[model samples]
Target: MVQEKQSDRQQRLDNFLQAVEAAQKVQDDIMKYGLEAAHLYCDDIDGDWLETWEEDEDGQQSFVELVTNFLQSDDLVAVKVRKQLKDKSLQEIAVNLEKCLSLSEEDDRIFAVKKVLLRGVAVAESNRGTSSDEIDEIELLDLAEELLDKLAEFLVSINR
Candidate 1:
């Protein structure tokens, strides 16, 4: 039944869309409301992930593959980062960006978010010319969440 259901293009598209939105929300929750808010957001990401489609032997165009392809072609994150960051490490910033949704492993997103947060903090400290252990757990979570949200938006823009 699940396999049969996965074959429907419309269903797949819908699932892809929902996944993008849910992933965005998780980023939002982690960023705006607080890291504790992530507990609420994590429950929402229920859809296909991009890595899964690429790993399959058949190389079929699952909804995730289709969405990810469109996203890369559109280059949504490049425009987004340019607008959001005034920091000097924009080039390195690009490298720090990570994918937000992973249907097979939701917890993985949190780790990705942490990497983004650390990168941002490093950039920020360099820009400010100061170094201190003033890291707030909630704030770090928030930065990760915002980046994830932006990336998810980039992924969805492929549909548009």
Candidate 2:
């Protein structure tokens, strides 16, 4: 009985360690990419912009062959960097919003609030017809700061 209990504890510990490692890897990817990742999360566009579709008459190409052909034709490096950027940005927004709301990371409302803030950014910049990704570094910094300030104010007012 003691051995069985020990084995169960060991399994739980191993599962926890695996979870930590996975989270660390995700954090590393986000750090390498930046907040651009968050902007992409709110974007309505599909990442399939890089894909090409062809009608196969006989469908002679096996799935593996089609995958190989696609991989050979696609600029995987660029796509990866773009996807990573989106993830990083999303992480940044999640962290900041969590701080702003004094909420835990696991709170589901964080996702909804992040989307609302991104919409605010879009509405503010709609006059220029430029998306957040198109904004230069300085502009992005200023815009982010401004959005956060406004959000803080809005949050404060609702508590009154």
Candidate 3:
């Protein structure tokens, strides 16, 4: 019985490792796709506009892909709820924003909130859009500011 239990534990560990590997692969794919999209957008729009943005071609690609996949998957609605919960914590600051806002249980708003929050965290933690630990102090600060602005905007939108 002890041997069987040990075998079962080992099997579960193997399964968890496989799941982690799969998740990593998915993340890599998302980043690649998002970067391509950013590059295209940069080519068409102002590259300079994206320059100050926290997400580099790669980071943007990852974010976009993750968001897209999350939205399309079974977890779509749940992701939104998570964003709203996060946003709710920022209600005080959001109340002061000038933009006309409206509340929605809609998937889009939740997705937007998640993106903003992720971007903010990414900027704060890594100080770079594409990858962490690659950015200078000034760049990181700038990205954090931008992310905060977006977060505020998202919160305001949802509050209304």
TM-score of each: 0.35, 0.25, 0.23
Candidate 1 achieves a global lDDT of 0.56
Per-residue lDDT of candidate 3, residues 21-120 (tens digit): 9788667766879656445334556446655464454444323333333333455342442342343333322332111123343344444443444544
Candidate 1 lDDT over 36-67, as tens digits, reads 78557456445454455454455454344443
**Against the unseen true structure, what C-alpha lDDT does each candidate score?**
0.56, 0.48, 0.45
Where is model 1 more than 4 Å wrong at Cα? 1-88, 98-104, 123-132
Off by over 4 Å in 2: 35-160
Q: What does each candidate score in C-alpha RMSD?
A: 21.2, 20.8, 20.4
Tell me the spans in candidate 3 whose CA falls farther than 4 Å from its real position. 35-160
At residue 71, give the lDDT of candidate 2: 27
- Per-prediction backbone clash count: 1, 7, 5
lDDT of 1 at 126: 80
Clashing pairs in 1: 31-142
Better of 1 and 2 by TM-score: 1
Candidate of highest lDDT: 1
